[model samples]
Target: MSHYAVFGHPVSHSLSPRIHAEFGRQTGIALDYTAIEATPAGFAQALDAFAAAGGKGANVTLPLKEAAFALCSVTSERARRAGAVNTLTRNDGQWHGDNTDGIGLVRDLTARLGLDLRGRRTLLLGAGGSARGVAPALLDAGVSELVIANRTPERADALVDLLGEPGRAHSRYWNDLVNEGDFALIVNATSASRDGLQEFSLPFALAASRTLAVDLNYGEAAIPFLAWAQAAGCRDRVDGLGMLVEQAAAAFELWHGVRPDTAGVYATLRGKDASLVTAD
Candidate 1:
């Protein structure tokens, strides 16, 4: 059986093993998937040891995605654009990196939710790896304009500069967002939600017309954001669970050359009602 695993710190809560097991069973592929807790200082060593042991592929998560990007001998264009990588594959004695977070978000919003992003104003909150991974995909999906807001304005500016002029993307200070008019879509890409921070205030007018509010943090972390959106009168709210499953499917395809049926797997995983599970 081929071996695969997800690497991250505090990986005990990861549901990746179960998700991949379901995928393998459904596709009739024999494989073993597990989660390995790896600290930033030892991530490269752990990856090397995994590859040395004939590991086929690996999914990387928080505090290490950037490290994975640095360790890769080569990377996909999307991963390069995002400045981080979440999936790694062993090929020709080298590890290649790729980012599936963007595609996952796009698939969930466009394919699953049946929402059109073409020419819509978007507000992206946060300036971390999650924000970087999904920004390009949103731009590519034809969002009219994207305003990246962060607590540290410089980071937002840096991200906008990194993305270039691909599709009308810009930066804004977090507090200044209230005066910048409403957005058709608002995405919470911050770890603040995961830390149980108090709800941030946003203009009630922001959700004027079918605004979709999505939080990149899932389970317990997602509750605060979803509740805030609901209280703010934005009915279309979704957690990151769907994005997680979709990204895993993308990673599986990259490694196995076959995309598993994500809908069934996603529904099954979401039904478990677990708290603080890590998908990416």
Candidate 2:
């Protein structure tokens, strides 16, 4: 069987193996997928070894996304725009990279959640790789204004510069989001949620009763942020679980030349215990 895996610093919690196995079963594509924990220092060696061992493709997560992008001999336009790579495929003696994070998020929000993003004002929390991968997609989805805020304002500004559409997307300091304006959609693209951050501390003023607050983290990692949104009276809240399945399907299509049905796979995973989950 062809081999594949997901690379990340703390990957033991990944649901990717399960997701890919379901995709293989659905599409009748035989493959082996696993999760490998790799710190920043060991990522390159592990990836090189995987490629040398005939691994066809792999999913790159967390701190390794940007590193994977750096190592790619060729990258899709989306990956170039994202400045990160969440999916890696072995091409003709080289690594080809692509980022499906933004597309996955948009599909989950618009198609699965029945939320229309067109003309919606959006607030994105965190300017890290996770935020970088999805910001362009959110802008492309017709969000009226996409504000990228981070603890370090300079990083957010740098991202806006890279995005280069000041009229549509810009940066705001984290402290200024409350005074800036209310948003129809708020996305948490930070690692803070995974760190068990209890107090999101975002201004309730920035959310209307109908505001959709989404954490780009699922399971236990998502609880505190979702609870904060709920306490702030934002009735619409979502975690990143749907995005995980959707993105996996995209990668499966890339590797297998067939798109697996994701609804059943998503439902199957959601029915399991929350403690056994991971998404990136």
Candidate 3:
């Protein structure tokens, strides 16, 4: 069996192995996908160890996405554009990086969730790796406006500058939520929910009746924000489970030169109702 792994700091909670195992079973690819805990300081060493162990490909997550990008010998245009890498292919002793996060998020929102993103006013919370990986795609998906807010305003501003769409994308302080007006879509992309570091402290006014709140997190990490959206009266809140499945399929395709049926795997993960537990 070919070796594969996912690297991140708090990766013990990952369901990548389960998702990928299902993909391999569907596609007849013999592969082992595991998650490893790696901090920023030790990521390179950990990656070196994996590569030494005959690893063929891997997935990068969380704070490690940019770190993975930095370690890549080559990266796809989307990876370059996003300045992050979520998928990695081993090529003759080199790591080739690509980002499928953007496409994954877009596919989930438009294709699966039945959301027409054209001209939707959106608010993206956080400007971290997850935010970077999906921001460009959201803009390209025709969100009329994207206001990025982060605890660190400079990071948010830098991401906007990278996007190079001042007319459509702007950066704001998280403290300015009330004045920023309601959005048709709000995405929680921060690691806060995963870290369990602090209360979300989001405003109820940030939601409109038409608003769809999305948290780029699933399982325990997803509850806080999705619950907030529910309590804030937004009916169509979504967790990241679908995006996770979609993105995993993209990564598996890149690694194996074949695409597996994601619907079955996603359905399996999602259970009989095919609805997130967050749904009413």
Candidate 4:
């Protein structure tokens, strides 16, 4: 059987295995997908073992995305642009890398949510890999302006410098966000969701009734941000579950040459059947 896996530190909580299983079932392809947790020091060795064991493709998350990028013999332009890789395919004894996060977020926002990003003012709440992965795609979607606010302003500025789209994208300190005015969309791309209800405060001034607030983490991780969005009277709130499914579908297609219907799987996950699949 063809083998696949997701590599991460705290990977036991990942939904990739079940998502891919549903995709395989839908596409009439049988594959083995598992979550493999490895320490930062062990990532390279663990990956080597998986490859030797016939792992054809893999999904990478968190700290491993950048490491995966470094290990790739070839990379897609999007991966280069994001400075990270989330999907890896074995090619002639080498690994080819691609980033599906941006495309996934775009498809979820545009196709699933029916949101028109053209000329929309967006506030991206991080300068980390997750934010970097999606920013270029949002710019490509015709966002009029993107203001990245990070606790460490320099890191955010560094990302703006990389993108080199000065006229449309800029970085701001977290404190200055309140004066930036209302945004059409606000994406929480930081690790804030993982920490739950933090002491951090969002600038409610940046949100209007028409603003769409998105937390790039699902389930309990999304509650704090979504709650703030609701209290601020934002038009809508969403979690990253849709992006997760879409990106997995994209990776599955890349590996197996078939895209699965995400709507059914998404529903199954949201309807509480997600925990039925064991990580091991």
- For all candidates, the clash counts are 0, 0, 0, 0
Q: List TM-scores for all candidates, in order.
A: 0.94, 0.97, 0.94, 0.94
Q: Model 2 compared with the native: what TM-score?
A: 0.97
Compared with the true structure, model 1 gives a TM-score of 0.94
Q: Estimate the lDDT of model 4.
A: 0.86
Q: Assess each prediction's global lDDT (C-alpha) against the native.
A: 0.86, 0.88, 0.87, 0.86
Model 4 TM-score is 0.94
lDDT of 1 at 195: 57
lDDT per residue as tens, model 2, 80-198:
98888999999998999999899999998998888999988999998887898899999999999998999999989988998889898888988877797688889998888666566
lDDT of 1 by residue, 17-47 (tens): 8888988988899998989889999998999
* Deviation in Å, model 4, residue 148 alpha carbon: 1.1
Instruction: Give the winner by lDDT: 2 or 4.
Output: 2
RMSD of 1: 1.6
Residue pairs of candidate 2 with colliding backbone atoms = none
Better structure of 2 and 3 per lDDT: 2
What is the alpha-carbon lDDT of model 2 when measured against the actual structure? 0.88
- Using lDDT as the measure, name the better of candidate 3 and candidate 4: 3
lDDT per residue for candidate 3 within 1-280, as digits (tens), equals 9999989877776778888999999888888888889999999999999999999999988779999999999999998878889999999899999999989989988888788988899999989889999999999899999999999999999999988889999999888888987999999998786565545679899996789999898766678888888888888988888899889889999988898888877778878433332110
